[model samples]
Target: MMESMVIFHRCRSLAATDAFYIQQLGLTLWHTQPGCHIYDSGYGYLGFVEAADFELPAYSCISFNCTDCAEVDRLYEKFKGMKGITAPRRHPQFAVYSFFIQDPDGYTVEFQKIVKEGEQ
Candidate 1:
């Protein structure tokens, strides 16, 4: 059987990234390696490694799946003040109620709830 998963990305400053994911996003710190910090996202894990010279990808997205539309709405209200945040709305094509926000590292983080089961 397959276990859980962890997605890793490169970050310029560990301290700043830590604050954003931990304080702002309210993710629990799952583990800490020498230059990497992993956060538990309830569904899976997200890890960031300190790399001063790393060039961030032009397009990168990290998405979180909410249990329902209400959860998605709550997250939108919580992070509405953040830079690059979008208003939550239903995407009929994708069958989701979702929104996007930019993390401190300029990563596009999406919060979404699947409106149609088995679509995603």
Candidate 2:
């Protein structure tokens, strides 16, 4: 079995992206390369590489699973009033309570909690 995983993405400015992931999202810096920085999300690692010509993807989403609905709500409160943040709501079709926010690099970041297990 795989022991761990890391998702890599491109960013224009490491400082800005770093601040968003570190200060805003509260992810801890896990590792660093010459032009890339990786953050530990407590579940997995996310790596951002500096790319001057990076283009934002239309349908790419980075999602985090919370422990429960209240945890999702707590994250919603932290991200509220931020640009591109949506109000948290239940998605019966997906059986989750979730919301989305745009990262500094225009990436879609979702926070969700499973409300019903083995339903969908």
Candidate 3:
């Protein structure tokens, strides 16, 4: 059984990435090293490594699950009016209330609240 999780990425600006994740996204700083910085994601951890030739990924997105729809709406307000942010909306196909935002490294981070059975 899989019991653990971690997501890692290559980033060019450690300070910018840290500020975006910690200040903007509200993730906690878990640790740091010469090559990478780690953030606590409640259930797991996210790591970003310093790189010189940083190229954005073609088809990758990291998602954070909120406790409820209100939290998702709160985060939508928090990230609204920012650069590279999509309007917060619902995904009927997936039954998710979510919004997408691009990080400093141009990675899409999705904040979502899943609809439980009989709630949709």
Among the numbered candidates, top lDDT falls to 2
- Pick by TM-score: which candidate is best? 2
Which sequence of candidate numbers ranks them by TM-score, best first? Answer: 2, 3, 1
Per-residue C-alpha lDDT of model 2 across residues 2-113, encoded as one tens digit per residue: 8999999999999999889999999999999999999999999999999989999778999999988888889999889997999999985878889999998899999998
For 22-120, candidate 1 gives per-residue lDDT tens digits of 999999999998999999988899999999798879889998999888899898998888999999988858787899998878999999987877544
Clash pairs of candidate 1? Answer: none
Residue-level lDDT for 12 in candidate 3: 93
Give the lowest summed-lDDT range of ten residues in model 3: 83-92
| TM-scores vs. true structure, each candidate | 0.90, 0.92, 0.90
Checking candidate 3 for backbone clashes, the offending pairs are none
lDDT of 3: 0.87
Residue-level lDDT of model 3, residues 1-120, one tens digit each, is: 987676899999999998999997788999999979999988999999999999888878889999988888888887788777786678968888888988888888898888888764
Selected candidate, larger TM-score, 2 vs 3: 2
TM-score of 3: 0.90
